[model samples]
Target: MRLTRFTDNALRCLMVLGLEPTECITVHAIAVRMNMSYEHLVKIVQRLAELGYVETVRGRHGGVRLARPAEEIRIGQLLRHTEENLTLVECFDPETNTCPIAPACALAGVLDEALTAFLDVLDRRTLADALEPRQQLVALLSRSLDPPTPSSTELAS
Candidate 1:
């Protein structure tokens, strides 16, 4: 199953934070580095803060850090939080799904199993696990921010 944009960005944010455990990363800084909209990141950060996934510190020096250790932040937990619904079919949704034969639908059961299996695999991993090769991840993220070396004409300006 495909993840939504919210989940994708949340995972990216967590990965970036995982790389710099010793530093508190400002939401603005993360948004800039990730090439994401600052306003969107602000909302995402606020949600994360409310969920106890990340801690927000207020003030000029304020920023965010993982509320718990990277090791403790499980991948499945994030997936669960980020996903609004795991239903693959209309019948999977109990409220709106009024399929006439939902009680006998093997398709729905199979889909449910698939979703659970997917989460089960992710559940075995943590944010720390996802952050392997973190130095490389940091370098990949920081590349866009690197200042280009000026040529003579450019330097004059």
Candidate 2:
């Protein structure tokens, strides 16, 4: 079961916010740091805010921050909210399923069990768990904030 880019970006956005829990980081800054489209990140942030996962501030210093502590943000719950469709197979969605053997397909049951197990693992984890390597993540993300240096070949020209 693959997650959509929307969910992926949402996770990335949350991880960034989790890095600076007390500070309100702008969506643009997150986009730049995460190499995401600003407009796309905006949509993700808006959705997260509406879901009570993020708090948005306004004005000159306005930006976004986590609404709750990272430890409280369960990965499974977030994924369920962010993922539009959790259906792992065509049979999972009866409305659009055109499989002739869907009615008696054991594969569907197996896949369903697999999907449940996948989410179950995520359910046991939280944003804080993902951020356990805080110092390492900070170092990597901070590198993106630095201005790019000219290549050796460019310097020779």
Q: What TM-score, computed on C-alpha atoms, does each candidate reach?
A: 0.88, 0.97
Kindly list the per-residue Cα lDDT of model 1 for residues 30-74, writing each as its tens digit.
Answer: 998888988888888888888888888888888988888899998
lDDT of each: 0.86, 0.95
Which candidate comes out best when scored by TM-score? Answer: 2
- 17-74, model 2: which lDDT tens digit per residue? 9999999999999999999999999999999999999999999999999999999999
Candidate 2 error regions (>4 Å): none
After TM-score superposition, the amount by which residue 53's alpha carbon in candidate 1 deviates from its true location, in angstroms, is 0.9
Q: What is residue 18's positional error in candidate 2, in angstroms?
A: 0.3
Candidate 1's TM-score: 0.88
TM-score of 2: 0.97
- Where does candidate 2 have its weakest 10-residue lDDT segment? 85-94
